[model samples]
Structures are given as C-alpha cells and as structure tokens.
Target: MLPKEAYDAGHYVGVVAHSTANNGDSADGERNYESTTWQNAFVHFFVDDQKIEQVANTDYICYGAGHTANHLGYVQVELCQTTDAAKFTKAYAMYTWLLAKLLFNRKLSVVDGVTLMSHAQVSAKWKESDHTDPIEYLASHGKTWANLVADVSANYKEMEGTDLKLQTLILYSGDADLQVAADLAQHFCCPIVQVAFATSDLLLSATTKYQVGGASAPAGVTLLSGADRYATMHAVLTLLGK
Candidate 1:
C-alpha cells in the first residue's frame, strides 16, 4: 500500500495533471503497475478513454508529483497514455472534467499556473522535479497545454454556474427558526448559521441566501417570513424547490 500522508496545509491548494508516458495503457493497467511500485511513485487518480479510477484517496497526498508539490498540497491526477486518436479524445474530456471538478469542489478558481497546473508547469516552477510530461504527449495528439487549461476553465465555469444555483445559506434568529433552518439546511445539504453569528465571508460565498423567521438579513439576501413556523417552512420549501 502507498504510504498515507496529509498535505502540509491539510488541504490541497491546486491540482496537477500528468500523463503516464507509457502509450496504449488503461487506468486499470497503470493502477496495477503503481500498486506494485507505490513506494517509488503513485497518483490519487487515473483516467482513460473509458473510465476515471481512484487508485488512492484524494483526501491525503499522493507520490505523483515531486517532493515539493506533494508536500505543498496538490491533488495529482494521471492520464493513461493512449496512441489512438479516438482514445485520446475521450480520455482528454474526462481528464479535463475531473480536474475542473476537483478545483470546483475545493472552491478554488482555475488559474492556469496556480490552481490548475500541468506536470511541466510544476517542474518549471518548483525545480524539485525535472520531468516535463503530458506536454509532448498532448502535442502528439494535437492538444496543447493551453487547450487543457481552457477546457478545464470552461468546465469549472459550467460547474460553478450549475452549483451556484443550488448553493444556499440559511440564517435563523430564534430557537424555533433554528429548528426549521436546520431541517431545511440538512435537506438541501446547505449551511445553517444563526443570524447574529453569520460572517460576511460566509454570507458572500453563497449565491442563494435565505433568512428564516423575522431575522433581518443583509441587503440582497432573501427573507423567508410567514405568519407562523409552518408557513415559513412552506415558503422556504417553495422558494428553494426542496
């Protein structure tokens, strides 16, 4: 088994994309190889034309990148090498989407050299590793680093748009309001904060904001108030479509 380690910061700051460098390989094949040589090197995920497989837990660090990046907290994903144009095209889509999804999940914006990086970029920036991978491999299939960045950024934006619509923050003032807000928050998988305890950063992060009961929310926030508790719950459920 690959040794388990946490990132220096306790959470990943970005994602590093790499290619296996061995052509005509699938995620399963690459994973099997890594399974044996995990002490030398291993990544959190592997992607191929047909699937994306998690060879290790992303919550912890992997040995994919170099010492600097692995310690600096980057979630690394490897794309299995493929010679076929069709296979490359399919794997590329999944690879970019996975990168975007990882960044999006962390609430990190896709900044090429920072939030989203190629192995080549990692090597050039840190100098901890001399390997420049996925660059020449991408060129072999008519794809460039710029292409990957743009594609991942596009996917990130798409996810942001879709998720923002569902993202919500619920604020409650009183005990009764708290009970209702907690239920709604759990149902929607959102956060519930007391009106007095709400932070500006937390409030601003959510696109859809709600205030339960007669609690006053910030200027642009939506207030869910009704004659009684059940009525307020109804309004909240109706507005949030829960």
Candidate 2:
C-alpha cells in the first residue's frame, strides 16, 4: 500500500528476517524479495550480500511492523540474513548504508530522532504488537542502538561527497550543513572550508532545507543550492575550482 502513496508518517523502521536460508545466495534472496512482493507482505527494502532491493515505494507504506497503524506509517526494511559472524558484518554494513541513503533522500539528518526507529521500539511504545526484531539479532553481535545510529551518521557523511575531490569549500546563506565537510575533504583529498551566501540551484524542497546548524559559512560567500546532493556536491567542486 505504501508503494502507491506517500508515507505521511515520515518515519522509518528496521527489521530482520526471523527465518532465512543458511546459504546466503543472491538467487535465494531474490526469490524471497519476489515472494514478499507478491504475497503483499511488503517492505521498502531487502538487503543481502547480493543487493539492496527496494520492493515498495518509500513515499508510501508497507507492512511487517507487526501492527496496523505502524504497518502503514513506517517504511519497513528487512536485512536478508546473518546466521553467523561474517554474514552479519556484511549485512550490517549494507543495512547501515541503506538507512543513511533513505535518511538523505528524506532530507533528515542522521542525528534526527524523529524518523529512524527499530521494530522493537515501535512495539514497546505503541503496544501495536509484542515483538522485537533485529535487536535480538544485533545483540548477539554486541551491537546496540547507539552503534547503529553512529553507523548511519557515518555513512550519511560519506554519501554527502562520495568520489568527490577536496579543492572547493562550501558556502551558505542561512544555516550550514557540515556533515559533508569531512567527506568533501576526503574526496577533495584535503580540507574544504565553509563560507557564506551562494545561488539557488537545488530547491527540491525549501532552499535552506538541508543546511546544518551551529556552523556558519564565511562572511560573504554565494548562497548556492544544489538541485539535489549531486548538484550541491558538484557546485562545491566547481567553487573549489578543482
């Protein structure tokens, strides 16, 4: 159902397949993805060693949260399998990356608490059902909520400037988004500074929508906006003159 509409809930939750095959085969996971799609037991994404597939529309809702309201309110993601340590590590990274991507697409910061959630967290608060997920699986690996959120934050920073180089600095008018600064430096192969004021290019949402706080751009830089992260990143590159 979420595939057909928008997720007004503006929240996302994570889950793990309670039962999966011992053989972590891509074909096997693909079959599961297809089955879930047809069975109408849909979730937004499925992550395995083979791929991270989006089965439903994130703008809409999907089931598997174990309750009616949440079933339709949150974007549900299922990690394919992790019966052992090696598999867990890979699946964990993929899950973290996917979560960061989703958060970025939604214009939410990794530090923002409103959108990210655990299935167990939903159950505990809403009494929608009495099941905890991925938690039990994560606990066995010595991972916790703090660890997961940190991973997302880390991944989100990387996304802000993947494959980017380090000549350009970021400028802004209103607030600033510095999460991408370290990443920009990594890609630019050096450090980039934040300055003030630029043009308006990316306005998918509000002009200053994705800007971060506390950090200020230089006193008089152009407040340019990228159409999406790609444009913003390139604009930064162009400004860097790299």
Best by lDDT: 1
Per-residue lDDT tens digits of candidate 2, residues 1-242? Answer: 23454444555443222213333545356556556564445566777766777766665666666555444466666766555788778877888888888777665666533466776666776786676766676777788777887898898888775524233443332323464545544554543343334333222112222222223333333443465555665665665586
TM-score of each: 0.70, 0.56
TM-score, cand. 1 vs. native: 0.70
Could you say which candidate leads in TM-score? Answer: 1
Taking the tens digit of each residue's C-alpha lDDT, what string does model 1 give over 1-242? 67779899999999999999999999999989898999989999999999999988888899887998988899999999988999899999999999999999999999989989899999999888888988999999998999999999999999987775547788886788888889878877898888888878777678888888874567767889788888888988887687
Which ranges in model 1 have alpha carbons more than 4 Å from their true place?
Answer: 166-242
Reference-based lDDT, each prediction? 0.88, 0.56
Query: Model 1, residue 83: displacement in angstroms?
Result: 1.5
- Candidate 2 stretches with Cα past 4 Å from truth are 1-3, 9-40, 66-72, 111-113, 161-242
Give every collision pair in model 1.
Answer: none
Candidate 2 least-lDDT 10 residues:
204-213
